[model samples]
Target: MQVEVISSVNEACSGKLQHRTAIVVDVLRATTTIATALAAGASCVIPAETVQDAKQLTKEGDLAGGDRFCRQISGFSYGNSPGQYRGKQIEGKRIILTTSNGTRALCKAMRADHIIAASLLNAEACAQLAWELRRDVVILCAGSRDSFALEDGLCAGLLVHCLRQHDRSGMLQVDDFGSAMEALYRNKANVIMETLAQSQTGKKLLRLGQREDIVSCSQINVLQAVPYLNGGSLIQRLPGTIAQTAAPLC
Candidate 1:
């Protein structure tokens, strides 16, 4: 039940996460979008590290979505906005997704014992899942480029808080990044939304007139699904079900 937070994919690779449960966070949009999409009934999501890869998947007849910074790609069917997933007929469909930071972080965690994608949208669910597993956990934040993002850090803090509540013994270990995130959570109430409106990436979205996207991504725990990478596709773990199906790669 040790807990640690890595600021980026690079930091995660430098540590030992092979036997640990990995939680990938990209609160600015990507992970948030995935959680929202799955909650809205998407069958599965295929996360690609690059927009080019996502486009290629789409050209091969995959249902693809693309986002760089914040705006939609030229030929993408959907942008990275969580609001676009509601009531859509995504059930049993494969979503080829690419994003600025989150996808890369997810790819890096693919080798972990258990990899779960997290965001403000599914923070509590993810934390609860991690606690249930009772494994050492690494919270990886997909920061902008190689730098830290405040929104992701805040989400990590919320997760840490949740996990601590579930197990308050000395079993939980907090790293430097985790401590910083907890501090941010103490001072900044609802900072994920505010940071997105003012962050470098968030400002780019605003310039693109995607204020609605920021608002959508900023909403916390709106989804109950915990998306995990299984056999290379993102699938939701349904509650009360000991068995699950792996999403086929398109």
Candidate 2:
């Protein structure tokens, strides 16, 4: 397997993304929010790069939602918070979402053969899909404001850790940066809370009084909802996945 990490949306746009499986990580919120919505039984999640594009897709009564710079848009029903999606009403509903960075990364990575939203909420499932597909993989981190964000990198590293743990063949080749990310995850797995609380994006959220989102996004392996892009929208692939409430990481 050949695996690499694209540290920011700019890098994703500049990369040759064809014939690859992209695991998009926006751990501060976007990817985490998608996972929770899918786990709550949303029919599909449509990612848009702009607020106009997100609103235009409401033809089928798709719920328009998103945020820009940590502030919810004025007309949207919900912001980019994981807690907002853990509801029974979300079932059978399609969400048209746009975000400051995460959705833009997703749009940039659209050329890949497969695109999946991932976070600590569904790290193992994302890894399992990557191994099963056996495609060239790109762990694309949705960095904030065209620069790197620690939480996304940490989640990418978590995916790398799980992939390495599951692969006994020792044949997978990871680039130096990927290896360093994996090492970072291995070394700091015990201090996830502090690590997240002190991260740049996390601090921004903290200032906005959105502390619950930080805590909610920190839990690991709690959701089986793997949100994969299919036909311009992301839907949960839950054929035989475990259905249960999310739990905190160890």
Candidate 3:
């Protein structure tokens, strides 16, 4: 059905997402990092809206990682870089994550019936899963610092475009921002990686000497992981499957 794109957590909070499917986008890093972590075999990711929350969520064998405004938070085990989460070292461990915007957005949309983490890395998989659920979808972008972020919007656009391709019924109702984002994705499809590298968040990371992270996070459709919030954790699932053991929470 219906498709809408929320530019910020504030926008999401002003509306009702309860019982609806939400795909949260933070393409510059957070969502991309989470998907990469899962693909690398991290057991699950627990998003914390604040550093305090992240510290509280950490337990034995759990890794505490996150950033604030693209800088690694003091005492964090790792920053929100997808490259830092590869290989078997992080396997089977829980990640307590806190971010400048993404985790806060996740917390704000916790009431949604379904919440999937989306990045350029897992856009297609997320769209396919949302289509299968047959629920109204909200593409909620974790905009940087309460403002709209280009990378997140572009990823939302990609999700919308993929959803439109899968819907043969011609009933995909897209709101104004959704249409703009879809067009943005289509228009910039040719130089997406380059464009993302030049985005605000991308540039910020670069100034922080994290250019490799930008390149890694900008990779498109390299992961099939679809991480969703369930039972106080974000668990990875296939396009058509879900976490059966998850308990409902909002």
Candidate 4:
């Protein structure tokens, strides 16, 4: 298995993701929010690239969510907070989500054979699924403001580390950037929360009074549910579920 890591959403190219498993990481919020929503029993999360698209996608019962400049869009139901998605109100509801960077990364990875939404919360599960897919991997980090965010890079590194662990045959080949991320993850493994709290996006969230989001997004491997793109929506696939049986659990 070959693993390559893109530094940020801006660095992702559809050509590079073709026929590969693309894991999108936005640990500070976006991907983490998706995973939390799915785990909390939301039907599906439809990622939109723009606020207009998100609004257009929403139906009567659908919830609109997103963030702009690190703040929730005025008319949206929620912002880019994992804790907000975990609410009981979101149960069995469809969410039209648009984030500053995360959803854009997902859109960029649409050309891949499999698109997996991942974060530090579910890195191991995402890595296992990517391994089972039997394809080369591309990890796209949904960095903040078109630049690499340490939190996203840390999640990418964690995924790389998990992938390496899964492929015990020593056949896993990671690109230079992936290797660097893996090193970063290893170095910060013991201080995951602290690392996130100190990241660029993390500090921004703090300034925005979203420290809970940082705390929620920092829990490594606490969630067994993996969120992967199915058509235009993201749904959960549990650890042992076969691909054929993977359906929306909303």
Candidate topping TM-score: 4
Clashing pairs in 3: none
Candidates in order: C-alpha RMSD to true structure: 4.7, 5.7, 3.2, 3.8
**Candidate 3, residue 3: how far the Cα is off, in Å:** 0.2
Model 3 per-residue lDDT tens digits across residues 49-163: 8889898889888999999888889998798988889988889989999999999888888888889999999999999988877678898999988889999989999999999
- Which digits, one per residue and each the tens of the lDDT, describe model 2 over residues 1-250? 7889988887875355788889899998999999988888888899998998988887765678899999999989889998898888788899888999988988888898878899998999889877666677899999999999999888989999988876798877888878888888888799887788899989999999999999999998888668899988998874245334422211
lDDT of each: 0.80, 0.86, 0.88, 0.89
Could you give the candidate ranking by TM-score, starting with the highest?
A: 4, 3, 2, 1
Weakest ten-residue segment in model 1 by summed lDDT: 241-250
lDDT of 1 by residue, 7-68 (tens): 87667783567878899999878888888788777878999988777766654435688677
The TM-score between candidate 2 and the true structure equals 0.93
Candidate 3 global TM-score: 0.94
> Which candidate would rank higher by TM-score, 2 or 4?
4
TM-score of 4: 0.95
Assess candidate 3 and give its lDDT. Answer: 0.88
Candidates sorted by lDDT, best first: 4, 3, 2, 1
